[model samples]
Target: MSEVLGHHANEILIVSIVAVVAVGLIGLPGLFALTVPIALFGVVLLSWVAMRQHDRRLCEQCLLSMPLNPSERAVRLKRRFWMAHTGSEPRFLIPYVVVLLASNFATTTTIGRIGWAVMQLSMVYLIMSQSTHRKLQPWCPWCSEGGGGAEVDETDPVLPQDDRQLI
Candidate 1:
């Protein structure tokens, strides 16, 4: 439970920090406020990537260093995958959206509006990429093996594979 709260706190912290910095650097422009959300989302994404990458490292280290039996390893991997799933699930996206939307509403901007626009569009790209990555993580041979999250959803987007992907 604490871990779940911790997860949210960490994400909120990242999003808030990035959003504030972007807002500060860009200066809140009420007229050009659209970009603020974009910048906030963009920085939030960068921070998310950094956090996940670190988690992946830990997963890999566990995979490589743990002396568990095959069954134990599988269990461990599933736990890790679910833990991540819990953290990254769509239900958790609400706070971020709300926060960014609120931030954008806080001020208007004129200068650097283009920069904000870029950040917003880039955030869309990042969101799409991460979405795809999330769907595919269960199937990703490397991620599953390293992050213990490689079990591909049985969904048809990716073909069924041998048990090797599970490992």
Candidate 2:
């Protein structure tokens, strides 16, 4: 559980830091406030569209490094991005939405806002990490492979198997 929490914390912290720096550098009038929210919304919409297709192939580094035809490549790339963005499931998005909504009603003061941010971030991280760990971790090449995962396997038998053959 600590491992899961730690990973989410690191991810959120890095993203927060980068966003803060970006906003600082660009300033409010530069459309940082406007474009980021739109982009984020677009990403969520695209992720939902991709998830509707329901492809369950592991999209970790190992699969990505394999050579694919143009059409197959496009599909795999969509699946890969969807998995990374949405944990390959719609249910996983619930906690985040709840957190964002709840945060608004929970805090008004500066200290309250700070405390709420910490509490909510921690809560969401714990929930997401535990709930999605098993499903999402397998799609991570290293975690699924006991930490010695290969980045790519050129000799993998699936490489020579044509997708049309299965169709």
Report each candidate's C-alpha RMSD, comma-separated, in the order given. 13.8, 13.7
Q: Which regions of candidate 2 are displaced past 4 Å?
A: 1-31, 44-55, 60-100, 123-132, 135-167
Model 1: lowest-lDDT 10 consecutive positions: 54-63
Q: Residue 133: error of model 1 in Å?
A: 2.6
TM-score of 1: 0.27
- Any residue pairs clashing in model 2, and if so which? none
lDDT of 1 by residue, 54-143 (tens): 433223433454443644544445544444444355685566456545555444555345444444443444443443344335443445
User: For model 2, where is the 10-residue window of minimal lDDT?
Assistant: 48-57
lDDT of 2 by residue, 75-151 (tens): 44444433444543458667756765676566566665655566444533443443233333335433444553332
- What's the TM-score of every candidate structure? 0.27, 0.33
lDDT of each: 0.48, 0.45
TM-score of 2: 0.33
